[model samples]
Target: MNPLSIERLKVFPPVSNLDPSIYGPQDSALKEEQIICHLNGMSVQQAIEENKLFILDYHDVYLPFLDRINAHPTKKAYATRTIFVLTDMGSLKPIAIELSLPEKNRNGPPKCVVTPPVDATTCWLWQLGKAHVCSNDAGAHQLIHHWLRTHACLEPFIIAAHRQLSVMHPIYKLLHCHMRYTMDVNAQGRQLLLNAGGIIESHFFTAACSMEVSASVYQNWWRFDMESLPADLIRRGMAVSDATEPHGLKLLIEDYPYATDGLLIWSAIEQLVQAYVHYYYPEANIIESDSELNAWYHESINIGHADIRHASWWLKLSTPNNLISILTTIIWLASAHHAAVNFGMYPYGWYFPVRPPFMRRLVPNERDPDYTTFLADPEGYFLASLPCLDQMLHYISVLDILSTHSADEEYLGDRKDLSAWAGDPEIVEALYKFSMEMKKIGKEIEKRNGDPNLRNRCGAGISPYELLLPSSGPGVTCRGVPNSVSI
Candidate 1:
């Protein structure tokens, strides 16, 4: 039930200022005292003040959809809120988990509340609760994080790029490599993975609630500005903006493999983008006068993602700096971000028990017939609650395919056709420098993976976090950041 790293941790009680009543359950099942003991003597407020307390909050997001999700006989889910502390070792230690079900009506509290178990039976029950929480996380990671953030959200940009930006356009040349196979992959996703009664709906815990939940997240949480690495970290409350810090942000947890390695890649990409954009649009007025660039930007915002066209966070493409930041964000999303979430799927989830996509049985209670059965052989009952054999195989097969890399896969900086862009010597040099930076970043990731202190990546049984390692040959090597979301 522990998160892979502190990157998954969000600041306690998110920055959202919504009324408490809007939340699923107003009361926290894990009390202050319960977490205080685990905080190494720091008070809850102290931890919050220090940015040490974090939460994997699935409560409000999943709560409203739980009723429809649980309607299926074999599929069940819970609205879970897990809180954790950033230990001195820089690992995240899960202190409490609050599993809740919706109230019959709006007037009452949740139908059920489960916390850490006090005794053996409740410990077994607690395991069941953790399983349910895992089920919720797995569904969210796929639908919201992988598909929505990296795949669906970027489709409009891809379309606008192709439709508005001419093939010979500098911006088109800059973005074309990152857009490879994206449309093909997304078309396949809609037809197979996300289709009605398809793999996602049939196998994931949310089941029928999958797309509805994904749409809800896109409506409520996604932002274009937050797509960048530093901005995203600050928004999650995992880091504080500090002028004196590296990357201009102080990480709350210094040993985060994804963030630590990704910041290096993000900076590299930003440098390459700034250089390229400056070369093409030397003056701010050049961006303003560019007809194709303006059309592409307008189409991406106004037509492609029309649902959130009026979003407050949309960046204006007026200045060279603005264009640099925007292009950097787009490239980062296509390469590092997608790779982090996608390529590691099979390595981390091939074992169904590690990250079960769905649970068959609900939490057994005294009111249910299975409660007695649960007490007699808790292990057996727990195993029964997991996805059936066929479903597990289906889940593994899908992940194995999604996580695998093709032989012709183009990594972040593997461009071999620099001769095509030789008309511009500055752009050619910039691309060459970017490729070299990627190689350095790849080596740094290898060195960090060997560091025993970063427990999330290195340890006796821990699989090194190689999802952002920048390159790979082929197959599910569990390392490699493809330029686009090919799978």
Candidate 2:
């Protein structure tokens, strides 16, 4: 017979009309006599190949068999066992039986089988299934399968993605490292990581699938919540406070109207940082400087005045390191904001305050600008954002490595050391490369806007923020007038 036709055969026997007369009086003896004889007639391989057998719990087969036997008018007692086999469809017979021996004698209900705990591999498979089902894409299915087969696991990839999301939020990289290294060590830890990966994977698949329909669909699915502001505003607002200290002096020198706006931008950056810190490292110490800065901001706003600014004083305070920190923060925020905007977030604005004005002017009307140009070219925006994403990924890798040993002692021994990591060759190199790429892309965006007159007016003319000099002793260098800042 053809294999397909053979697949249609019903191999197991029905027990609705079982005869009770064939068996002896004792239920246990009857069961043994009926089942063993049938099994001896056929091999296990034959039963499987011919699809002649069904595997199920003993109680499942027993209850129905008992009903049939009872219905016979001449009722007979049924065997009580944990496992049972039914065979011979023409002649209904309980073919084989096995009694379960409990390890300990205490139970309200008997279990037919004890399932093992889910492991990392099991979680990966579950995630893969969910991704495939949710996406319903052949390419995605094949990609997941390939990853599973090649990597022997998807934990690393999933964990990496999870780490990236964490960074995008206000979570500290150190705490994430701690969880991966110190907290989760055993099978339970591994399973938790797998579970996290599963969550990330679900969101990722959703975002991926949303991209297929429309940019609006994608943005809606991954949009960031605008209701609750990021905590970094409170935490990192101090940096802005310090930078804007010379605002009074800057105004005296040049009468720049946007100095307060710059303060606001810095304040927003702080909130963004605070959001991450609170989410990722709630236990982290609230620096007194931040509090002081918050007070300064409120006081400045209330009094409608800022103190002493030669622009040089602010420039001096803004040190290359501080500027880089601010830039890095912006990059991370942009990456997350880009993801949200790409996926379908409303407001459809870049996270940084500086960029939106320029982006707005790019359109025909600032009030009723058409987003078709912006929305249609998502891939370009995504490409523009890659450098920042790559930087975050690099940071995650560094953290993961540091987690393996002693992250605190090795990298964060002191406040100076913490800041020093910002200037590290690898990190600086990544940031520099990112700056160059953004400069290139920013120009492209500028050119695409088709407004030669408005080209450099919206602060798009600002030079890419670069670390003036590598760390030499303590002080940082700022080369320019600090007018135009590119992330």
All candidates' lDDT scores? 0.82, 0.26
TM-score against truth, every candidate: 0.94, 0.16
Q: Taking the tens digit of each residue's C-alpha lDDT, what string does model 1 give over 244-342?
A: 987888888787777888899999999999899888899999999999999999999999889999988899989999999899999999998988888
State the lDDT of candidate 2 residue by residue for 166-232, as single tens digits: 4522223322322232122324422532244332222222222222322222222211111111222
Q: What CA root-mean-square deviation does each model show from the true structure?
A: 2.6, 30.2
List, in order, the clash count of every candidate structure: 0, 23
Q: List candidate 2 segments past 4 Å from native.
A: 1-344, 347-423, 451-487
Q: Candidate 2: worst 10 consecutive residues by lDDT?
A: 1-10
Query: How does candidate 2 score on lDDT?
Result: 0.26
